[model samples]
Target: MKRIIIASVAAAALVGGGTAFAVASDGTDSARSSSTAFQATAARASLSDAAHAALKAVPGTLDSIERDHGRWEADVLGQDGTWHEVTLDANAKVIDQRVDRDTDAEDAAEAKALRNADVSATEAARKASSGTVTSVEFDDDRTPVWEVETVTNHKERDLTVDAHSGKVTQAPADDDHGDDDSGDDD
Candidate 1:
């Protein structure tokens, strides 16, 4: 009788453990499925019929879709040598639109100007003393500025460039300039 009782208890524990493992596995799978379904739903909701139609209208091809700043953006190139940036909502509804001759062209130009200015500034600083470029950044209000941190033989320097003009305007006398103090710091 004692042996039978012990066997029954051991069997019960084994069965219970197996059941618990199965339940845990099922829970994990369910959670994963739910997460995937949610993502799909969100993607579908982000675009509206009109937005979809607009995207299809773009000439070249649908290059890519991305989420930026809580908005959906589609990159499309028109047959007329124009790049269209379509912003949409979570429901795929068109929120805003932009047409650029070339995407990132403006930014590239700005960056080039900035780099040239940096080179010029660095040369000037070298003339004065030796220094290294640490970092570059824009200023408040999206001003394209190069915040250059240079460790000169004499001192560290910080420089700001104008986003529109790509000109180096100011340089800090000290290298202790902190990180980008932008509103998006958080």
Candidate 2:
């Protein structure tokens, strides 16, 4: 399933705008359905139109982009594999660009952490509360844990899965800044 999803994402890498999204089963006993639902939303979202617009103010291709609360945070993977963080305003204009950072070491750390992970993000979502996966990201550092977001009880809640132990725990109030949220421009 992981390989299939990866292949799907790879095949859809260069896609833009809103795409189809797969929603997981709802872990409730209400009239809500408990099956995968196809919705219109980008799957990979390596970059968004706004992110690309903001990219005009930066240099590099999009590695990953996620909503940081109210703003869009993007990782611009440089041609040389270096990583830079680009923050976009509500209008999709570049508001801040972080300094260039080495992705080699960070990549290695994340790979190692994931290598030891027993629960995949999908499995973590199952262990969470049968909620649909909204997003999955690391701790923004060398942490092997994965932060999984799922919509349950008609709201989005975050769960942390230990990369090494596969333990699931409720994450904080979606407020943690690391390499992705690093830097403050003058």
On lDDT, the leading prediction is 2
Q: Would you estimate the TM-scores of all the predictions?
A: 0.29, 0.39
The C-alpha stretches of model 1 lying farther than 4 A from their native spots are: 1-54, 102-186
Cα lDDT of candidate 1 equals 0.44
lDDT (tens digit, per residue) of candidate 2 on 42-64: 33332235556645666544444
For candidate 2, what is the lDDT?
A: 0.56
Identify the candidate with maximal TM-score. Answer: 2
How many Å off is the CA of 111 in candidate 2? 1.7
Instruction: Give the clashing pairs for model 2.
Output: none
Each model's lDDT comes to 0.44, 0.56
- lDDT score of residue 140 within candidate 1: 31
